[model samples]
Target: MEKIIKEAIYIQSPTYIGSYKEEDCIFLLKDISHLVTEKDDKEREEDINDGVHYSQMLPFEDTPSDEYMNIFYESLKENAMKVAVNTLRICEQILKNKGNDVILVSLARGGTPVGVLAKRYIKYKYNIDCPHYSLSIIRDKGLDENALIYIINKHKSTNIQFIDAWTGKGVVNHTLEKACREFNMKYEVDIDSGLAVLSDVGRCAKIYGTREDFLIPSACLNSTGSGLISRTFLDDKIISKHDFHGAKYYSNWKDIDCSNYFVDYISELFEKIDTKSGDKYTDINIKTAREDLIDIQKRFGVDSIRKIKAGIGETTRVLLRKIPYKILVSDINNPNVKYVLLLAKDRGIPIEIYKDMNYLCCALVTFAE
Candidate 1:
């Protein structure tokens, strides 16, 4: 079926909690195949480098076992209160600088929930509803043009602030900037490529909530934490030029879905927590992260920074989505890194304690080179 807001149409899924404001934006996307016959991590990597997009090659791993899921739940309980408060603080700074008329366009899948949380908190604190929309961005393929066109038509591109859940080695952030430049040059339209994320451990973005690199409980699970929506996809056959790319709405997984629950739960904590001024974490210049990434690449004899995903959130992503070669930890016992340690062990991967980095840990993705 279709959702009509003003004059725009968005085909939505029953699995998604409706978050669109009736006056501002259209969440346009197509419901496509959910199954990829799950591939082993190695296969996903090989396919990714061989001129095929990773999202088109595999389905995600099944939900983590109860033990791993327990780690995430515990993290949520321990960190959510303070984290929510800090999030509001950073968001406040962003709104202060950008003004209240900004729109949040989150990078799909990983970014979707972070955008939702920001929108919820903004409304709760300021009594002003911010429109949040999640759209697809593939690393090599660039941003989804059709979706961008749709968003631009519905809202002013100048007011759009792209959102991401976190910054790892800042690949997606750079990719976004490059993609926006390309979009502007190809179509002769301006859309801000500057991204705002809940965490910026990679030190890549200007507007960020925190740069702490801790486990964001939600980073511990797949699909379940994201409105039961599959990672965004773009294949020529599966997505036409004019369609808003595609994603599978996991309606069958609602009973296990914590997508909306995660956002709502965090939003509630905002009420109980004080929004006082604090420097729990602040921005780090991108130069440091860049120089270090290059050093790590040379030291490890690695082929590319693309394979060296740093920070706890990104390390978790390596375990979750990619084939992890090895994990280097500043502290194996860091409470924030419990999920990473568990994921490494569960996958039978090696973990090395090397304490010279800025982040809690770093994950060396399987280097296909």
Candidate 2:
């Protein structure tokens, strides 16, 4: 399947729906906000379980409440330095390994903010203005081929590095590797699938800032935190072969959108923290994390590993989007999961104290019948 590389349909902040600056990152996604209808969360979850590809539909996102917003701000204030330090570490590693001319292709939504922060850090520290683009990569549908082709045509494939905020069950990591292989075969270009993340709670990625399952405030909100952009959507009915994967821009949410605030707050701390010291990647027991996940699946009777979302970020996502069966927390008093507790309580979802769990918290998605 030979694909003719065409100029990628890309957009920057303000011009599109995102609040990011023009230089922060380019979004390689077509805005299909007007073309697709939103589905109720529960209905969407049930449809996904019935073998409907999740990327085909967008879930309706509600405006977060004042209380929830408070939690997000509190979490950010408490963990700003932690996130800043990790971002620096990841950026430094990128320069050391991939060199100065690396192109950052952050997986859309979650990775957008992290990519923007990394790009800012590289310029601030090394004075290198590396190009950054946010593209969509659905789990089953694979990387947006058109987006990949567009980027490959513009930048050196070898210099491309994928970035994401954190790893959940490492599903995306495996998905990314598989997609890259198929894409390379089709396009005859080698794009490395190595994902650089701020938090590697799943202990999956080769490059990560920390293995601690702490709260990344970005996970606290939906599209509002991610440039008011809906999760990347792809439907054959709406998306064409020549079109990039689709996403809806939450234009109405601009007033309350925290996308820019999240990045700006963390980026501001870059100069204050000493990136040289205490910036070592602590080795985590990947085997143990994997074993723990398997044990969790068995104990919870979850048939699919995808249903068991581990780590603070993953758990937050389950609470925000999926029909959660229950939430497990290692410690109830830990400030890292304050937002989790709030969400669970608000939803009236059962919360269990799993003292021996590997992650600080984990969310079990209900098997929608």
Candidate 3:
């Protein structure tokens, strides 16, 4: 296991076609799905509250159908330029604040796409070849300490910024903050947990591209759009101390990999954006995600806030990653959510129309064991 873990990463490797530039950062992950250790949707509710780490439960993976993928791509193609500009604008301020010290450590696999785009935009606009490292961070497991050690060993800067695609009830956001504090207290290294995301509907991030819960094409697919990597995984049996968390590199999916295309499509749009007036999103939906999530937890009787996922991106994740009891979509017919509807239907999951909700949709985890 140690041999495989060490050989899996390419810290000195250059950016290549099959793998990503993330080769510079340590990737302490490898595919362990063959263990067949994953659980179904019915096991989600009982095991979630058991307080075991979510990844340890191993939710079954279901790849979205071709129709579902096409909708997501079309949505991204239409809005790529605009979204790219907004992302660049948000990342610009972050880059300025961090200066020559910008070390973007995106929480893989969701944040990998955003991190790459930010890296590409910086190269496009400021001529800075910023280094982006995609690492694993499970909410309950905390940020990967070994990964941080690997980065510090290379860069030695506390100016690391965590990035994610969006905030869903801000659980991961909150988890990051807590993880940073714990890491600092344990190792005396200062790491900020304020994540940079493209969408911050939960208003948990100070550095965000937008607060709208829209369809992010990246959020639509599992790993095909995320560097052909599998969702991150961790377990004591497969992962040992002094090792980074694990994830599978889906090398076989290279033909369909949209990771590079997604970034380039957005990078081309950075030139068109007028950074002077890109403040188009809502001014921080500033209510605490904790409070909002409490209400959601009560309403859904999900028993735990972690089981109740809010926002369009997160709801899509629930359907994709876990067994969702029902999806609360404001409009199943909205083209933005068309893929979501298909995903739910494909899984035989129920969809409900809740027009007055704050987000595009919310997915409640099955309460039954």
Candidate 4:
């Protein structure tokens, strides 16, 4: 497929739903709120497992309660320093490997906040105003080539570094790798597919801040935490060849959107923590993690590995977006998953304690009926 050379529209903060400043990052996504048909979580999950692509529909995102918001704040307070340290480490590594002029292309939704923090770190530490943009990359549909072409034309392809908040089962990494290879072959340019993240619990990415599957508070909420933007959506009926992948801006959620608050809270701690002092390279047992995933599949009779979501971040996502069958936690008392516990309890989902698990927690999706 030849690369489409259409210029997709890019939106900045305030003009769009995100709370970040215009200079922080530009979103390469169309507002498709009017086109999206929001479905109940159970209905959406069933449709997805029945072979319907999730990108065809949106899950109804409820407004989090004050109590839930309190937990998010608590988690932020507890893990702010850790997040700040890792953000700096990831940014430093990017500069060292990709150079000062590198463009930070964060995978939409989850990666947006991390990209903003990274951009802030680079500016504060190196005084480099590197361009940052958030674009969509669906699981099976591949990346929005139009968005990639737009960015490549505006910036050097060699300097692009993909960013995300964390790795789940490394599915996105695989999707990104395959897409980048195809894009490079067709366009005759190399865009590195190695994803940079704050947490690499899946032990899949080559560049990461830590291998610990701790709570990243941003994962606690949906659009409210991610600049009030829906997860990237793509449907042939709604999205055109030239348009960027679609996303719905949660305009009504603006009053409670903590997107800016979460980033700024962590960014403030950047100066206090010494990113240079921590051990950037830690021993990560990818084999054990992979083995555990297989074991979970066998034990739970999960038909597809995609139904088994591992790690704190992934587990939270399953509870939030999918119809969770059950939640497996290494330690129920662990503060890292306080929000996860609350979510599971709220949904009346079954909880199991897996003491010998590789990741802190995991969530199993209900089989389609």
Candidate 5:
């Protein structure tokens, strides 16, 4: 298919909702894959504790069980529209507050969908076609220089807002700030990484649609939830001096395509949102989330802060990819928590339930390194 936008914008492949021909000018956001595979949980804790980077390993590709999938679909049906509506409401607020002059830079892979939704939201609601670009931002490594250049030269935008799907432990939030600072120092471009997201369970970023970290339905599935694009990689073989970081499209997963379903489900909810008036969850903040991490670090006596991953998505990630040390859940009764618990039990990892967590019930991967 031809590219979605008329300009020189590029779309990557393997996006969750749809696929583009290999020769298409735009790249699909679906090519980034999970490095941590299902079996890694056995050694996840030790490796992370021992200074192994979490990005180096692949998470297990455990297909959700039939019952678990049913719950995901049920949640999609029950709350997808609500989430979408609220998301649109948030987008409307952001556009009014920030104006259509700023650039929308999505943190590639995860933030691409939200960026696209925000783009669509702007065009549909205000009749303004804002430019949207998904850029690669690897934790620790920094944002892709070539991608930033491509965007800056094309639109000449100085004011940019970075985006992601949701916040987890606020690691990426900090990572983005650091990356932007280095980029500005090197290239003389002033880009602020103050991020916007669908949810801010970590309470870190200034702009977001929701503060609750319950279950984003999108978190339950991988590429299928976003555009079928794999995660971005900055490795030598795939990237070069002039070219942007590249990824492969999982052209094979068309059989179980859920990309459009996820996009449209949220887009349709735009009508239900009041746009002008809605209850914003502004009271919840990131300080508590950070404090929780500090407590976990103190309790576990781990040296590195990165080892203490939290939230459902991060915890689910621990079970799927890392060799989990243990899982501290918010509620054993929560259905979403059940699968994580099952995965933990199956792996023989310990699990403890606690009800104190605000967005997520529990935390995971307490490294005793």
Candidate 6:
């Protein structure tokens, strides 16, 4: 029993593909950010029209010119502490709402760091050692059923909360909901798909920390920001029935791993916080985001509600992942919008400067005939 348990320690498992190196924790994200190709105009049009999965292909990786890197470094230096403190407060709120015994299973790649950070906060603030698991949730393909099985067997089906970095169209939430339903049917286990995110620009999730659409700092870079794990893939050739989704380990990219820097930046700010009863934030305002998303969606036009991707984080994702027709900017003059403009230009997507968008920016998806 001891040997088996030890063997399973850091095992990628049948549902995961990457081997554990050191605990960078940003594994799958690092790979996807680098490997995924940009969709050309023709290719982008075909994808949006056909409703294909975008993860299968990667765009050319943008090597931030010296200017962008300088800006990114400056942003990280300035904002990492604030983000960490805010995240700690959010984690405390979540723990209070759910009770301290809840299990945190982060959607692999993006949510892992958030989960780890949240776990750290719980330990520092409340002395709770919650277990954090990073699992896969493919956009349309859904969460890995095998991962669900592993959790059920190991943890005996405790209260599970799904975590992510941010939501765009709430694809991860919807994907997990459907995946959990199928999992219950197959394994006779139930895991609530209700999610928690650092930000909710899509207005899809029930529990979240913030609605701010500003650059997450993490979104500005790929595996360098995440641990050096590749994106998860379900291709039959690479993944077998018993195998976890596959990801490549970029051992070569160790020099660029910002996982520690990101974590340390946020964590070091813990001393500055009061952690007192009245000063700490509670998620009383989560409802506002839901209403805000709906209002913005309708204002944009009920028909294009799906196209109106709000929040700076989501807009950045649209620029990265989807065929963006045009960018709706909240503050056209904001220097923060420059990166969005840079990537949009790379893909030939247009940016329309707007006076106001309830969120930071909205990306309209264009389908090509």
The weakest ten consecutive residues by lDDT in model 3 span 1-10
Q: What value does the lDDT take at residue 325 in candidate 6?
A: 72
**Model 2 lDDT tens row, 24-98:** 988888888789989986788688778888888998888987765886898899989999998887888888889
| Model 1: how far residue 229 lies from native, Å | 1.3
Candidate 1 residue-wise lDDT, 114-232, digit = tens: 77777777887887787777778887888877667666665544567887777877789889999999877776666778888777777888787777667787787777877666677
- Sort all candidates by TM-score, best to worst: 2, 4, 1, 3, 5, 6
Query: Which parts of model 1 have CA positions greater than 4 angstroms off?
Result: 1-27, 34-38, 42-46, 278-287, 320-323, 342-348, 367-369
- Candidate 4 scores a C-alpha RMSD against the true structure in Å of 3.6
**Per-candidate total of colliding backbone pairs:** 0, 0, 3, 0, 46, 14
Q: What lDDT tens digits, residue by residue, belong to model 5 across residues 127-228?
A: 877767776777777777666766666566666677788886787898888988987877776777788887788888778777766566666666565555
lDDT-superior candidate, 3 or 5: 3
In candidate 1, clashing pairs total 0
Model 3 spans > 4 angstroms off: 1-18, 22-52, 62-64, 284-287, 320-323, 330-335, 338-356, 367-369
CA-lDDT, candidates in order: 0.71, 0.82, 0.71, 0.82, 0.63, 0.62
> Candidates 1 and 4: which is better by TM-score?
4
Candidate 1 residue-wise lDDT at 293? 81
- Which portions of model 2 miss their true places by more than 4 Å? 1-17, 284-289, 320-323, 367-369
Model 1, 358: alpha-carbon shift in Å?
Answer: 1.9
RMSD of each: 4.7, 3.4, 5.4, 3.6, 5.9, 5.6
Model 2 has an lDDT value of: 0.82
